[model samples]
Structures are given as structure tokens and as C-alpha cells.
Target: MTTTEHTPAPDAGIQTATGSHRKRLMVVLAIYATIIAAQIVGSLVTNSLALAAEAMHMAVDASGILIALIATILATRAASAKRSYGLMRAEIVAVLINCLLLFTLGGFILFEAVDRWFNPSDVAGGGVIVFAVVGLAGAATSLVILSRGAKESLNVKAAFLEVMSDGIGAAAIIVSGILNVTLGWNRGDALAAAAIGVIILPRAFLLLKQAINLIMQGVPAGIDLEEVRESIVDTEGVDEVHSLHVWGLTSGVSVMSAHIVPSAAATDAGEHPRILDELTMIMRERFGIEHCTFQFEEASHLGHEGLMHRDLAGLTSAPSVSGGQHVGHSH
Candidate 1:
């Protein structure tokens, strides 16, 4: 069955949080953009692989914040009939793209680091030190700006964590440069780059997994399917539930739909409305699910051949029964 849904406006319940995110993200974006340009030139001048890799990472961060900023602005748009949910998912999409890109970049940096370990390159220590310090300052400032709203939503958290890691990465580059200057250890640059990759790969993979799950309409984190089903089954009037579905639309939003068979006694007593209220209240309080839809039906509807969503519809309807035997594939 096509699930019935009621979508709130794009900015519904999020304006205050995302409003602050917009201003902070723009400031952070500008800082990262400037750092990318400066660090790229510095990396070329010093021929430091670590510095170069950090610059590329910062470039990706800049792009992430840029996308985040756009998403924040789009999130403010009013919900229209054509775009009922508005563009709140824009933030989710932006974070998804950023994570995939980060994963790819981590692989590239690791490969280069290993190659450099075999055949070392000349790294100008003094130049690397100066640039790394400058980058660290910028990354630190940006981190402070983003950290304030890091817990507000997924988008804000991604931006905050990215900048925080970059700040550490910048410090590593500085350490590598010092080792290169004092001991002629060019290998430190490659080691530093590899370390950066190690830092990035795990975080990137975690974020990628989360984004793909959301895109595939999986259940939200921290929600248990069995528990939800039990709550509904325990309700006074509901005898059975089928076609139950739960999924997250984006951050801070959960949706659910189900088909329920009412108890014969409850039907005779006209307690359907009370049962619905109890079920709804349980879902809201126990599971924190505010949006739900349920279809109430009699047990006799179970074998209705033309019923949608009960099974796939085609020239042949679902196998009902045969003689005294059940005629269907056993799951």
C-alpha cells in the first residue's frame, strides 16, 4: 500500500537550531576556503606530502561546509504542495556526499604515503612548519565556531568533527616538519600523512554507513522493531498487526505505519477509539515516535483477494488455500 503521510514544513521545529547553524557554518566555510588556498600554495613550496594531503583534506572540509550552508538555507523554505516535506533532507544528502568523498580521499592519501615511504621526497622543513601552524590556527578557530551547535543535528555534528580532526592533523604536520628539520627524517612526512588517513578512514566509513541506511529507509538508530511491535500487540483492542513499517525521514523525524486487526470483543464494545489513543500514546512516550498511521480492519479481511499491500497483485492473486492444506511458500 502507498503509505499515507503528513509532512510538516521544511523549517518545522528546526528554525531556531538551523538558524544558528547557518551563521556559524558560513563563517567556518569562509575560514576553510581561505585556509585551502593558502595551504595549497604552502604545500607546493615546501614539497611536504603531509602538508599537501592536509590541504586536500581541508579542501574537502571547505566543500562540506559549503554544502552544509546551502542545505541550511534550503531548510528554511516553506513546505509547498509540490514539495511537501520541503528540503530538510538536503542536509542529509550533503553529509552523505561529504562522507563518500572523505573515504575516497583517505584511500588516495594512504597510497601516496606508502609510495613516499619507499621513495622519499625532499621536504622544506621551515616552510612546512610555518604553513602548518597557520593552518592549525585557522582550523582551531573554525572548530570553536562549529562546536557550539555540534549536538544540534547530524549536519552540524559532521562539520564540527571534521574541523576538530583537521586541527589535530595540522599539528601532526607541524611535528613531521620538525622531525624532518632536526634529523633529516623525510620519512616523518609520509608517516604523518598515513596517520591522517588512519584518522579519516574510520570516521568516514561510520558516517557513510549512517547516510546509506537513512537513504534506504532503514529504521532509525536506537529504535527496536520487536519492542515497537509488542507495544502495539499489547494494546487492549488490537488483536494482530501486519505490514508494520518504521523509518527515519531525516534527523529528528520518525515515521511509522501499520495494519491492525481489531479484537471481536473490543469491536462489540465500541472501544476502537480508546485503543487507538492508547497505542498512539505508547508509541509517542515509549518510542519517541510522534508521527504514525494505522488502518483498522476486521479479522475477516485477512483473505480478501483484492486487498492491496497484503501481497503482490497481478493476474494471479495470492494463493489462499487448497483443500485442508495451506497453499503458500513457507517462510
Candidate 2:
């Protein structure tokens, strides 16, 4: 006989986890709008490459904030029969698009910086400093507003990183401005622009990798599949585990499912629920897995499955007790 059961996730908790930072994201967007305008005019007037790059940085960040806000709203929607997970993945999708935008802007900035380095030009350093300071102050305020939410949501985290990079770019522009005014080093502006570009590319790539992993249903960060398997096998009544899968539905939520073989004694004694309870407690307390599904069966079940579906199971004999089959992309 086989039994399957699940520990369900709370609806309210999922909503709270995904959508608690909408207002903060809106505030950040407002700040970006004001800063972008100031920096754009400052760049044109001062003819400073560093100031222009910072303006482009702020513009992209402003756009990302808007997308993040929309995603945050979408993630709060209730689940439906057709879409069981609701729109929780919206934030992740938003992140993927934002990463693309960041990469494009970062690449352009780098190209410009390189060209400017070869042909250094005059820059009005005193005027550029005024705009850089204004941008820096705006970046600082946005950072404070989004800091709390960054830890809670990936959407907010993306916005937070953008603002943080803008802040750094602004500081770089200030240094370049000082050098141009006091030391007549026009190359400093090019150097600062290059630094800002270098900063942006790595962060964009990292965020893109994370979003792709989530979309592919790869195991969430900090979760070790081997550790989880070992813990379950160490349970008193569980003889073995097979077909185990763990992945994230979105941030702060992890789901796991596995087939378990129970000891003959435990099966005969009708202690299936007890074994499940212990495993569930371990998963929740230790692994932060809120949704779990477990199937209890006899050891012969794997052999039986192999006999019925040899092509799929790829097993010519009884499966090993030490481990289960872990399927991955064929390519």
C-alpha cells in the first residue's frame, strides 16, 4: 500500500512574504525620478563623462523600481484553480528583465568610458560636483527607504542594488570632479566612468544567474540536497528515500516532495503518521521547508515500478538503499 500526504502553506503568510514592500518601492521610484533629471542636466552642462554615466545609471534604476513595484502588486494576487501558485513568480520574472536592462546600460557605459579615456576633454568640475552631490543625497535617502525591504523580497533587493550602485557612481563622479578642478586631470573623469561600469556588470550577471536558477527550479540557496536526504534516512522508521525534489516557488518559500520506504515493523504497526510528523518537524524547523509531500511505501515498490516502466526508471534490478536516482537535464 502507498500513502501520500502534504503539509500545506498558509495563504496569508505567502502574501505577506511576497508583497510587504510595495509602498517602499514607490517611494524609491519617486526619488529616482528627481535625481535622474538633475544628473542629466548636470552632465550636459559640465561635459563630464562621469556625471553622464551616473545619470544613465539612475535612469535604469528608476525604470527597475517601477517594474519591481508592479511585480510586488502582482505577487499579492490570490491563487486560482488554473494558477495554483498565483503570481508569486512575477517578482522573479521582473528581476530577469531588470538584469537585461542593467547589462545593456553597463556595456554602453564601459564603451563610452574607454573612448573618453583616449580623448580626454574639458569638464566643469565645480558645477559637476554640485549635481553629483545632489544625486548622492537622493541615493542615500532611497537606500534608507529600501533597506528594510531588501532582506524580505528579491524584487526590493534588485532595486536596492541599483540605488546602491548609483550612490557609488555619484561618489566616483565627485572624486573625478575634484581632480579636474584642482589637478587638471581630465582623465580622472574617464577613469571614474570606467569604474562605475565595472561595478554594474558583475551585479547584473549575478542577479541574472539567480533569476535563471529560480525559473529552472534549481534548489534554493543554502539548501543542501545531500543533507536533507541524510536527515530523512536517519529517521527511525524510514528505510530509504527516493525521487526527492526540493525547489522554491518564490522567495522565502520552499517546497519538497519525496517517496519514502518505511520499515516493515513500522508499517505493520500502522505508525506511518508518526514518521511523517517527525520528518515534517525536522524539515520545517531545520530546513525552512514550509510545504512538504511524502509518500510511504514498501521497499519492493521501486522494484515493482522498474518492472512496470523499465524505460523511465532505468533500473534493471532493485534500486540501491544508499541513494535514489537524481534526474537532471539531458544536455
Candidate 3:
């Protein structure tokens, strides 16, 4: 029914897909939870808006990493009829939720910080610096743990970046604490909070855009669709390629489908199988795209049925100039 280079064993496939990835998330969860808990207590004791904002940031990040862990665990489950991709998109969904949470809280913190700037509050400078130092140490340790796996997935990257920002927040609080002690500038705490918000909002929206693109089936980053099309078209025994679609199931896995019209002159018996093998190998080894579907067909079906590619715009396709074939369609 289908062709593949090799089928991995079930358990090994599961491990390769998500076992180690889940472990990566698991390894960082307790560390983040500890940081969140510590920051919450520190904020309460010091009455520092900057430290409070950092605590809120860590809370959102801890929840996001938990969701990523859950997604990876679900991904380890075998694929089924209803859930064909086996919950890989769950990581993207977690990323979407994470971004939304960050944006909402970041805005709230920004507003609060601005208000505090007009009417500064007295903060305990000694407690603020002590808490900031502890938070910095925690954030640094988390970063060290996550550095190896940060590039593994979008979900992991979001979590890792959140910690990185928290580290910056801690540094900001430390500076504010010093200013409060030496210069008697109580508004320094509010300034630190605003700085944290400014740093957070942009990164959150960027991750939000990436999540939307992946959900819309747009091509993943660092990949060129035209490059993929040209590679397939230039392959031996292939003619015109059409309806080529490329997207990711998750950050690390890409899937594609295309209709390949084979050259008639080279259409000997059992020839397409070899061509299919070559195509499969090309996608796997060349493009790092292992999950691909290529339908081999004759050129007569070029402008007919689903093989003509999809018309995404709300307009009828014009007839081809060569054959005057009408390409009217709707979705």
C-alpha cells in the first residue's frame, strides 16, 4: 500500500520520537518549580514589584514546561486513526498557550509598573538584593540544564527563553536594589518591572507567530519550498511535480506530499518503484524530511482532479495557456 526505506521497531520508534524529549522536560520541571516558589516568597518579603513580576514570569514558564512534558508523553503513544500525528502538535499548542499567558501577564505588569513609577513605593532594598542573587543562581542552573535540549523543539525553546528572561529580570532587580539603597531612588523597582515587560512581550509575540504558521501548515523555518520542489523535479525519472505540500507535525518532524508525473519515455515495468526509492532517500537524507508521500502518475492528469494543486484564494483559477484547460475549483 505504501513504500518506506525501513520501519523502526515500535518501542524504539517511540523512544526516538519523544522519550528522551520528555526526559529533557522532566529534568527541568522541578528546577523551575523551585525557582517559582522561591521568587514568590522573595517578592512577598521584599515588596519589590520587579521581583513580583519575575515571580509571575516564572509561574507562567513552569506551567508551560509542564505542558510540554505532557505533550511529549502523549507523543510517545502510538499513532491511531483519530490522532494520526500522535499528539506531536500538542507541543505547538502548548507554545501557543504559553505565548498568550506571557502577553497577558506582561501587559498587566507593564501597567502596574507605569502606575508605580508615578507614585513610588518603599521597597526593602536589602531583601531585594538577597532574593535577586538567589533567583539568579537558580536561573543560571536551569539554563545550564536546558542548553543541551533547547534546540530540540519549539516548546523547549519557549521554556528555555523564559528562564533566560527571568535571569535578566533578576539582574534588573539587583540593579534597582542597589539604586534604592545608594541613591534613595525607590522608583527604580518600577523601572525594573517595566524593563522586564518590554523584554517579554516581543519574544512572546514572535513565538505566537511561529505557532500560528505551523498550525496553518505553512513551511517550517530554515526550509525553502522552492528548493524542495526543484530537488524533486530534477530527480531522475520525474517530470513535472505538482500539489507539493510541506509542513511540520511538530518542531522537529516535517511531513510532505506531492504528485509526481513520471516521464513517459522512461516508464518501463517496475521503474516507478526505483524512482520512489530515490525520492524517499532524497527527502530523508538530503532534506531531513523522512515522512513524505509522493504519488506517481501520468501527465494527462495534470490539470484534472486534486493533482492540480489547491486554490487557497477565494477565486476561480484561470485556464492554462498551453491546453486552454479550465481550472475552476472551490474549497
Q: TM-score per candidate, in order?
A: 0.77, 0.85, 0.88
For model 3 the local lDDT of residue 167 reads 91
Candidate 2: tens digits of C-alpha lDDT, residues 1-331? 5555555564445653436777888888888888888888999999988988988888887888787777777877888998887888887888888899989999999999999999999999999889999999999999999898888667777888888998998899999999889998999999999988998999998888888888888898889988898889889888777777898887766788887878888888989989989999889878989788897766556654544442343454445554334331111
Off by over 4 Å in 1: 1-20, 75-84, 137-152, 305-308, 311-331
Q: If both were scored by lDDT, which would come out higher, candidate 1 or candidate 2?
A: 2
RMSD of 1: 5.1
Cα deviation at 13, candidate 1, in Å, is 4.2
- Please report, in order, the local distance difference test score of every candidate based on alpha carbons: 0.78, 0.82, 0.77
Off by more than 4 A, model 3: 1-11, 14-19, 306-331
TM-score-based ranking, best first?
3, 2, 1
Candidate 2 Cα misplacement greater than 4 A, ranges: 1-11, 16-18, 306-331
Residue 254 of model 3 has an lDDT of: 80
Error of 2 at 98 (Å): 1.0
lDDT of 1 by residue, 1-331 (tens): 2223333334455452445678888888889888888889998999989988999998887888788788778877877898876776777888888998899999999999999999998999889999999999998898788776876567777888788878888899999999999999999999989988888888887777877877888998879987898888888777777667888766556778877777788888988778777877777778867778877765445456344655521213444533111122211
- How displaced is residue 317 in candidate 3, in Å? 7.4
In candidate 3 the C-alpha lDDT for residue 75 amounts to: 72
